[model samples]
Target chain A: MTDISRDDVQHLAQLSSLALSDQEVDNLRIDIGNILGYINQLSELDTTGVEPTYQVTDLENVWREDKIDDYGLGRDDLLALAPESKDGQIKVPKVL
Target chain B: MTKISDYISKNARQNVLEAIKRANDKNEYHALLSFTEARALERADAVDRGEITGRLAGVPFVVKDNFFAFGAPTTAASRMLEHFQAPLQATAVEKLEAEGAICIGKANLDAFAHGGSTENSAFGPTLNAFDKTKVAGGSSGGSAVVTALDIVPFALGSDTGGSIRQPASFNGVVGVKPTYGTVSRYGVVAMASSTDTIGCFATDAADAELIMDIMAGKDNKDMTTLPDFFKPTNVKPGLKIGLIKETTTDDVDPEVKQATLDYVARLKAAGHQVDEVTMPISKYALAIYYIVVPAEVSSNLARYDGIRYGHRAEGVATLAELYGKSRDEGFVAENKRRIMIGSYVLSSGFFDAYYLQAQKVRTLLINEFNKLFEDYDVLLGPTTPTPAFGLGENTADPIKMYLADIMTVPASLAGLPAISVPVGKSSNGLPIGVQLVGQRRSDADLLALAKSMEKA
Candidate 1:
């Protein structure tokens, strides 16, 4: 069984961009360990020369006319859904 | 259960009012999140006045809250979008509405459709329609319960893995998880993109067929959709069917096994050939699903970073903190667990060992299904390992909850069209569904076979 460490859990939370509480992190450490252990059973299979099936649909490069379509929603309608919008634009925390 | 014809044949306004009253009376199940009373009434009135004219005129229905719908917020049963009203309606909902189907309310689900049981919903779990003590199978639990309770003739649901079929089995209704790309996914919340499918729950297979036909077709908005191909066909007699041996092992509930065998007997009585078939690679489908699905889930759910639409964290100074804290506050624990697992497997060091390996194994699984389909018209099995469990039964163990999907995920992984048809009930009086799986794009034939099995 693969045992996930507390630090590993924190790193995963970081990668996922989630600010998990210590309690959540602790609980997830055990849960992720057990789940990994279960899924680890797949390692027993030898998958030599098997092409990975990324998608089941047998279509490729489905092209459309390069035209703009709003899909029935206007800019203001979507902007209104944001947490903070001002002067016809959405406001977010400064990246730097 | 109320029939589609029953709704359409009655006065449109009266149908909407009665359906709303039924939804209100069934509050103990907690099946619906919010009622779209005003919109539904106006639509019904339009139908009555001939302003709306179509096949489904005045038919009241429900959508799993994950769809972008009007009249109520598309919550996806999470606090993140608890107040996020949709800017545009989902294509599936719009199509249904075009046919004059009135969406009376939005249904409950596992928050972000991550968990097997609706217990993971930020709102309380939807109780089983048959037995209040047991769970309503989910993440389409509310849709199934509403249909089972006769609150509506039908309801729309999304299936990524066993979300639709598992709950339909638990609730004793016909649930259709159409072939991948069979229906346009525009306007629906994205889950595992490759496996996500739009389906519906109905009291009978014919009703399900009608709903699916109306919704099936390509939309320019969703490029993954296939051209129109879902025309219902009449299933011929003497069909060859495979009864999957793995689905009825000793580990499965005895009553569930019996229910499957009973359905097989009915198939034989109807002059169809049923043979026991084995697909060894299917044993790994659940593991592959957990890996591949979470990988996709991790990527798809990244859009909910509290920037544009969903709940935003207050008092977070840095941009990183805003993303982290808003997500932490918005998603349920199950959603976070899936996201982290996805992150773990998708990380560079583990990518080949986990995600890529699972995809390869997924190919092997699909190959096995294809080989079986060569000789069998369809694969038959019990939709779930057991009947509806108690509300808190599998909550403490995520693996146990995932096990509820074991019988249904193989088809999902392979992008096959599988339907769960109500066969009978358990000794405990809970519903048991028998699943029929068909090869890709065989949705029409699959529904034909299911419609043939209805009790005369």
Candidate 2:
């Protein structure tokens, strides 16, 4: 059995910034537990001294000039894509 | 003149026009989301006028809607992006266009590429090319079906896990998932970043290789792209091939198993040595894939909050309501399921137990693949457990849908180059495909081996 619990699911939802419904939470309680139970099978493997591979590309530290390259799009071009905009700034719902 | 090379070189415009006519004729399939008719015709005329020239000069192709293309909206078969017109083309599309390939249409896919079958597509599931009642094994389902139906000679697809290969197998086309970073992911919609790969579908291995050669390269915009290392090898000395024993178990459909064994027989006849090899960690691949992929999906998909872009809820008074309602309305059930699962696994307290454990298992799986590669030049297996199940067959159970990818997920986890090539067919007449997996940088070699098998 996995150690994942309801509170843990709630904490994860918070971390992921998702406000799941009560039904969703209940469903995930069982789904996450089953998923965790499957993933827990990995604990049997011996990964001693094995290095983790984060990225697949062999090249590293590819630096580029920090100069600002013109994307060639003007304010109108940018604002034209916005569903709501005012005076060149994208309009958003008030935060506070 | 009907050959791919001649068709690409001499009759690009005529070829695209003919393909468009055929696609229009078969209106029942709905394989294409939107056709870039005017743009494609104009580009074809340019190729004919000797204005644009390259290796694939004038060859027309379709891109999965997930890739941002100039002519049509990259909807990703989701309602959220249904009206979202891309400001620019994906780097992959741009690269292919640079080589003189014309983008003709955008193909259908599962919303956010979250499902194994295209049934989860917001627009509607793409019917199988061979049988209308069956699903076009998905998120790259439409891409595969279009190629199989000869709507286009080749199409571009993004494979997060088994999206490309499974569909290709289901449709009897060649599907290639190159080593991660072999092709840049700069403009494609992000889906499990670590596993997401841009690939292609073609009717044959040679055409697939040609397209791969054109698309494989380093891009300054995507830091993860490797320098162009995909050179097709001509050497045909016997190769050390491993037929993954786990994938050929009794659980696999009898026809799929037979097709795989038949292909192995052909490899042996071609003077390549075939041996059964075991990677014990492969058994845990699906579990690892679900945990790690959803964790990434949850993060990657968080950007669609209905604020900055794509769909907004109407009559929303509060910010939180807008986000929740818009997303709940826009995203399909599968997308929500994955996102919630992702949220559950990556939660703080359970991170060590779920996410971290999965990562460790991923490491083990990769190590096992590396060990196998030390002994074998390429790994062989069936691409899917079965081919093209009827639509709605696995819809009731999500795990059943996920299980279809069990044989293909190990390669995705390891970020290895893998391909699905048509070997034979089932007695019931469905196409069966066999998968070939190689070490990270051995994409070209793997394709070359596949091509050699074709000759044999």
Candidate 3:
């Protein structure tokens, strides 16, 4: 099994956009290690000529009309449900 | 005595009002999170007045809270969306309503559909129908309990690995996980997209089929949905049935194994040939499932940042702190565990070693299932290895909980249709269920075969 470390966990948190706490990071280090160890058993399988099954639905390139269809809900109606909104736009905390 | 149609035809408002009252009087099982009494009555009145008419006209049903329905907050038994009212209805809910099925309430589930037992629900655990102390097997625990209690004739549930089938088996009810794309998944909270399916729990296969008939179809919203091919069929005469040898292991609970064997005997007596078959790759199903599922969950749940919706933490000035604290607060321990595991496997250097490898393993599992289907009309096994355990039995250990899904995950990973039909009860009086798995587009045939077994 590939060894997972604190830095590895921190880097994953960044990739996943999760801001984990120090304690959480430490906890994840152990938990992730256990999980990886379990899944690593797959490496023993002889998948020599096996093709990966990605999407289950065999349907392909299901085309639809290129026309824009209105969902009928108005902007103000949708904006009304937003937890934080300003000037008819959804508001988020400022990011650098 | 009220047949399903009779209850459905009676004034929608009064029917739901009485059903809610009956559910409240029991108090033996805490199956519902909240009752949409006012909204249900309003919709029921519309159906009675001819303002609404369809297959489910005025029929009352409950949805596992993971589904986004108006009138009630869609809390997937997580604090994350506890107070978060959905801005819109799930595509599945909207379709059911279009047929006049009034959603009376939202049922409980494991937080983010994580655990095998509903003990992980943020609100509280749902009790099993037969024995109040035992768990309502989850993560669709409340949906199964509500149906078993006869509060509603049916309830909708989302099954990822074994959420619907395991619970239905535990509760002595019919649980169906239609072919993966049979029902739309536009608004149901994503748990593991590759295997996630919306299905239902009902007292009998007929009622389950009625609900499936209404909900099965393609939608512009869910592109993955297959063109509707779900027409109920009669069981073919002299069918070939395969009893999976691996699922009927000595390690499985004796009662569960006996129930399955007895079911096979009955099928044979009815003239369908029952023979033992082995799928060696079946042993590796859970390993592949845990890897691939968490990977997808990590991606799907990333949308729940503290910004747009869901819970936001306080005293966090920095944007990063806000996200960290909010997710840490909103999610339960299992959700965090899964998200972290997902992150670890999908990390830059480990992606091919873990995530990609798991997908390749999944292909082998599917190939084994496909090869078996070519020789057998359908595969039969126990829905769960054992009957429902006590509420806190496997809570502390995550791998133990994952093992409960061993038999059900292969069908899920293959995207085939499967069902759990009540066979008998254990000596302790807990219910036991048998699973019937069929080819990708053979959902109706599987249900028919299950119905024939019911007659036997």
Most DockQ-accurate candidate = 1
TM-score of each: 0.99, 0.94, 0.96
Determine which window of 10 residues in candidate 1 chain B has minimal summed lDDT. B1-10
lDDT of 1 by residue, B384-416 (tens): 999999989999999999999998899999999
Q: Give fnat (model 3).
A: 0.55
Question: Of the candidates numbered 1 and 2, which has the greater lDDT value?
Answer: 1
Quote fnat for model 2.
0.36
Tell me the lDDT of model 3 at B77. 92
User: What is the full ranking by lDDT, best candidate first?
Assistant: 1, 3, 2
lDDT of each structure? 0.93, 0.85, 0.87
User: What DockQ does every candidate get?
Assistant: 0.82, 0.43, 0.57
Of the candidates shown, which would achieve the greatest TM-score relative to the real structure? 1
Question: Judged by lDDT, which candidate is best?
Answer: 1
Query: Model 3 over residues B1-456: C-alpha lDDT tens digits?
Result: 123576756788888888888789866677888778888988888888999998888888899999988888888999988887777788889988999988989999999999788988988899999998899999999999988988888899999999999999999999999999999998899999889999999888877888888889999988899998999878998999999999998989999999999999899999999999998998989999998898898998998887777887877777877787788888887888888788877877778877888889989888888888888999999999999998788876677888999999999999999999999999999999999999998989988887777777
* Ranking of all predicted structures according to DockQ, beginning with the best and ending with the worst: 1, 3, 2
Better of 1 and 2 by TM-score: 1
lDDT of 2 by residue, B1-456 (tens): 123564655677788888889888876877889988888888888888989888889888899999988878889899888988887778888888888899889999999998888999999999988889988998899899889988778999999899999999999999999998899997899999889999999988888988888888988788888878898777458999999999999999998999899999989988999999998779889988888899899989899887767877777777776777777678887787788778777777768766777787788888789899889999999999998899999986677898999988989888899999999888877889999999998998888988888888
Task: Give lDDT for model 1.
Answer: 0.93
CAPRI band for model 1: high
